[model samples]
Target: MASALIMTGPLWFFTPIQVATTVIAGMNCGASTLQSPLTWPLLQDEAIPAQYSGKQTEWLLHGSEIIFPPFNGVCTVANLVMAAYCYYKRNDGLATSAIASAKLPYTALAFALHVATTVYTLTIMAPYNQKLKVASRKINASVEKGEEKSSATQQEGIREFRDAQAVWKARNYGRGAVMLAAAVANAVALKVSAGL
Candidate 1:
């Protein structure tokens, strides 16, 4: 039980770190474009699109896109491992309490929620890229037309993006907390069942 708790608790920390690092990388990618006029056009107008222009932005968005499916797969595997562990402990003459039994269901629910969020995020990225492209074109055209205020409008959009990014960070941290709590609960239950 102690070993299980240690292992799973690290995953709780790890997932959040992965999520946060991805977000930071994404923001860096975006901010990088904003800072570099040369890259801005490429990111905003051409191949990638403006919304995904910055280093952090691109990294986060792409990482999320690529990593999420595998992450979900791993999560499913982890759930199975945890369920098996619980069963093994119980079969080894370990007393099972309601709390100990509940861990499997809770972990399963968390896994499902993680997968749902991943899918939702992936689906939204393309449309978001499209909207960003339109916005970037308009902003760039306005700037080309000698509209000084265009910069202000662009800044506003960037600010909003940063705000949204912060929200994502918060959500990620919250998910980490949930995982940590679940780990602790599972560990405690196991200890209690073992009279340790």
Candidate 2:
């Protein structure tokens, strides 16, 4: 039962990251058309040559697309899996453990948060990608025209960044809650075992 919990916990947390990473990879494959200085806000300085600007934007976008998902996924998975193990061990003896009782509420809360985050990512973030694509096109065009393109990219970036941040925060909060609950459960289980 402990092992089962551990396995399920990690799987639940990491799956979202895996899916997000795949989506980013798909986006990067089509990013060649986004080769413009204005496509990325970080490289808008006049001192940077236009040629270098495009390359920088491409590199930054590619790196971000690859990195964020996997990093977030691994952290979340580890936290949840450890929590599951703790929770399971706490409840092994069941009847006399304060920790075991506490684990129930914590587990339920964490599970709910996880579900909410999943829904938001799928229903909201997935559709927002289309808007990002459109914004990318507009930014690229603005760059070609030697026009200031920060506004469009900034607006789009803000939206994407906010969505990503929310997902990440949700994962972190859920994981933390799970871990805390697990610790409490483990402590109670140990005490119960000692008394028995």
Best lDDT among the predictions, by candidate number: 1
lDDT (Cα, tens digit) per residue for candidate 2, span 72-146: 344345335534654665556744244444443443344344444345444654454444444444445556666
- What is candidate 1's lDDT per residue for 36-114, written digit by digit as tens? 3443234334354233444445454555556445544554455456555544443343333333354445444544544
Cα error, residue 76 of model 2, in Å, equals: 5.0
Model 1 poorest 10 in a row by lDDT: 10-19
What are the root-mean-square deviations of the candidates from the true structure over C-alphas?
10.2, 11.8
TM-score of each: 0.39, 0.35
List clash counts for every candidate, in order: 14, 0
User: Which ranges of candidate 2 are over 4 A from the true structure?
Assistant: 1-68, 75-91, 94-97, 142-196
Screening candidate 2 with a backbone cut-off below 3 angstroms (N, C-alpha, C), the clashing residue pairs are none
